[model samples]
Target: MESKKKEKKALGLAELVAIALGGMVGGGIFTILGVSVSIIGFMTPVAILIGGVFALLAAYSYVKLGVYYKDEGATYSFYKRTYPKIPFLSSMIGWFVIFGYISTIALYAFTFSSYMISGSDLAESIWARKLIAIGVIAVFALINAWSVNGMGKTEDFLVYTKLLILAAIAFIFFQNGTMPVSEFFGKLQVDWEQSHVMSILIVSSLTFVAYEGFQLVINGVNEMSQPEKKIPGAIYIAVFLVILIYVVISFAAMLAIPSEEIIAKKEFSLAAGAGKIIGIWGTRLVIVGAVLATSSAISGTLFGSSRQMAVIAGDGFFPRILARRKNGIPRIGIITMAVTASTLILVGGLELILEFGSVTFLVVSLLMAIANFQIRKQTNSSTILTLLAILCLATGTVLIFYYEYTHQWEQLLFIVFIYVILTVFSWFFSIREKRRLHREEFPK
Candidate 1:
């Protein structure tokens, strides 16, 4: 194994706050709100609140683990430090997630471009999406590669502007929202009683992914200040804020536009919903905000993906070429992630990416919670928290699998393919490292 040593970048609570807020404020709110309102109607707000609660629970689990480990790889490094076998699993999971998020970033960029063109005949061209997406990726890649501070500053800017716009939008609807208490109760009835409840849970689980971005910060645990205190604080704050934002946006859309129209064109639904409420000018404002939000998301994840690869390299599980840090940046890893992301954009798909990541986040969350169980030997508080974390995770997992069974085989296969590749690479790294270590202890 080749070793390349480097210092970890220093980040504080402000940085963590930006990353937490930026991660969740992306395409989901701009896109998912309208569709969710159509499916769940007045109950959309209730569903967002429920999702927020679970996200907060997961955030706390990561906080405990991050504080205890004080390692660069977040859960990957935290679990590795706790048990030797953890690295193999962590590395595979980390790699899988890097690809998943990269794909999502591309998906958002594509969506942004599509919306930009929809309102203007002059902007309409196949090249517009391709050109805009590449530009979005390039701009963020530069921000992330410059330094942690550069990336953090960009994210902080994105977070503030995005929140202000969303808050303004929410307030507008506060004055204009239409679902009264009686009307809400009346519309809450969705055909069959028992079947709708079951269907609601399944669909709601899918919607929950949009709100899981708060947990995205867990990957950068070692990068934050007072991570023990701040990381969890940021997660709780971000989730509550996100859910409230979503609910308000849902209320606004439903008040200003018909839910049925939004449902019919769910893919391009948000722009229409926005235009109806705020006019053509308003739609453009939302699209600009959406682009910035996703650009910030890509910047944060680009940093995270590089860090994950760096951890894998440092562990002697991957080519140490990626382990080298130049001026506080992992250049090779960032480039690799960027190139992979661009190729994913070319592939032009997000369903596969979402399905692949959906199941694995549970695995990561469950493990992080379980870590609380191991460290409990050191402190009973850890045990109690881990128990609570596990309870939430178990329920989320059950809901996820239930959706898997009912949804489609294609979704199931997408997840299975990632697992298979991850297992194969895990073995490849394990065998190569075993040989390298033996040579180090007892020279040729």
Candidate 2:
């Protein structure tokens, strides 16, 4: 009986990779392209590669702590266990990380809605998109609540299919390019010469959110087989593949489409660009690819992050009801995530959600790196790499803030206000936990 139970829980590498990639490739490429291009033009791919470097650095500590702690709570669990004496810090990380996940989910769902309606007469209708986004989130939340195996199989199909479609789109654009690849490189060189280094760096920092989902691999520690091997294998492989996909596809898009069009269309730029280059069929293909990408990402995120929510709840940092599991599914947590993400979709704009998610994840990953550094010997992490992760992540966080402050101070204030709310809630939970402990120790 015990053996059967263990066998049932052993998720293979392919499924794990699907989870990571599904969580990633969803909105990262689709969303970052226009924004990055608007800032650095042809240097978008270079900034993407740099963001990949940030992701790699961040992954170093996540992989280390994930393997060491083996907790489904992931970012929150890593921090809590590493600094067991600081309950407030633990609660705070939990709030930030969960909302960060919520923000990403909102971004994915909104992108999904954008592409879904890109060809329609109502494409410009914000409420229409919000309604579609809410509907998709609810659908995926139900899918996740159904069964883990069901969600994994669905993710495998969506993720692999989207990758094939996306690769084909890139190849098609490459073959039909208006200019030779060499000429494209020549233009990139000239564009780089004309661009500012700080703008490039800031865009790279912004792209950090696109690479945010790689750490979701750690959130599945309990389900996957061989934590020691699969955790690092899935994470590293998925991150590398995503970087390649982003660069190749972005290069292909820039090669074939005009930069002004991509910048103007924003979230639906790929479909719009493809429409101009290859006509309506190309537009449809891009839309299909995007919908699939964001769908898988939404599913993978709801699966992993909801479990993490349950773990945090079990630690008394959230409502106790979230801790309950039925058939190994965190049903309440899953539903809560869907509703909250839907709320964010209704309340936030695309760029606002994007920047907020990038900042939040960068900050959370930086904290994870710090926690890993604190227990490097136990996690068997290299001191140099861990410190590098911290420094790079800190720089990325600051760069985003600087960009927001200089260009959009109102957005910066709203982000800070959200953080203040999260901190207040975290503080309340931590204090309540302390009172409970005191009651136990001192007697009522």
Candidate 3:
């Protein structure tokens, strides 16, 4: 093991809740909101609500497992309990959980740079934007590297600020937007007013991903004070809060701007939409909020990714160095995650990365939900909830792949290609590990 370091103290329920909130309140809200609304128009809120239901179902699966396992595996943990023999595949899927967050962090860095450059009218300076993004990543990593407590406080404070800003956006939207509630409600179905059902579903699934933030809470089970009871409560609260905030914020953004404007800009593109209602300074303020929301999302994701890596390495699957902790921080894992995410950034275009990432993440969640159903047969938690999680995950998976086929086959295949490559590499690692063990035993 790297440095033979011991596991750090368990994180408290509040800290875990903050982690969950930070993940759910991630960088996407400000950026994707504009995109979803612009494409689907006012019906964006309905779409989010639809996504929210699935989120809650997924949350219940984790909530149930979190109370029991209180381990770091998240989805993989449940699977490990079932299929102990082929844990490599389970772990590979667990890697997707990390991949989703790490990629999102990269998105945050890029988005933050975009806003800083846009707000400063320096969008043309590519070098400066890249430098600033690196700086943002360094700043957050350094903070968490110093103290986990600092991350907890940072997320808590950011959560409140983020929520208040969202509330303010709703107020600005209600006061000045010309779009009627009737018009908003009418946009619910696929029609000429918006796009086709496939377009709406793709956007909805993308929007559904915004709800992926609840997965952040899984890590909290290990961190919570009264994990058995408190962690589940926190999950419900965070999921509910995420749903409410997203619904309100999306409604306002769509009302204030045309659907076309929203799709082009996405999430924090709310600044411009809000600007139409509250003026330039008001929009600028929202930009500042977007920076916080997006950056905090990165910080939370970094922390979660690091923790997952440390746990994985400790299990003897990965290089022992990844388990090393300095000042209670897995610096190696953090660096590795940062490097991995930045590498993905070279792919460019937020929508593509997030879309592909969502597919992988949703599949993992489906696996986790299914695991929960199997576990419930062996445990005592509500069978109803486990069944609900299964149904929700199934619906999401069907919609996700359906949207994939219904849109562009090549793009979807490209994502499947990435997963296949990773699986192949995982197989190689397993075979090599087995050979090394055999050599150690016989000294041949």
Top-lDDT candidate index: 2
TM-score of 1: 0.89
Model 2 misplaced regions, further than 4 Å: 2-10, 348-350
Give one clash count per candidate, in the order shown.
Answer: 0, 0, 13
In candidate 3, what are the lDDT values of residues 203-300, reduced to their tens digit? 66676667676666665344445567776877798889888888887776667777787777665467877777778977887877777777767887
Model 2 per-residue lDDT tens digits across residues 237-265: 99999999998999998888888888998
Candidate numbers sorted by lDDT from highest down: 2, 3, 1
What is the TM-score of candidate 3? Answer: 0.89
Task: Report lDDT per candidate.
Answer: 0.68, 0.88, 0.71
Measured with C-alpha atoms, the lDDT of residue 11 in candidate 3 is 60
What C-alpha lDDT, on a 0 to 100 scale, does residue 329 get in candidate 2?
86
**Reference-based TM-score of each model:** 0.89, 0.97, 0.89
Quote the lDDT for 374 in model 3.
73
Model 3, poorest ten-residue lDDT window?
A: 1-10
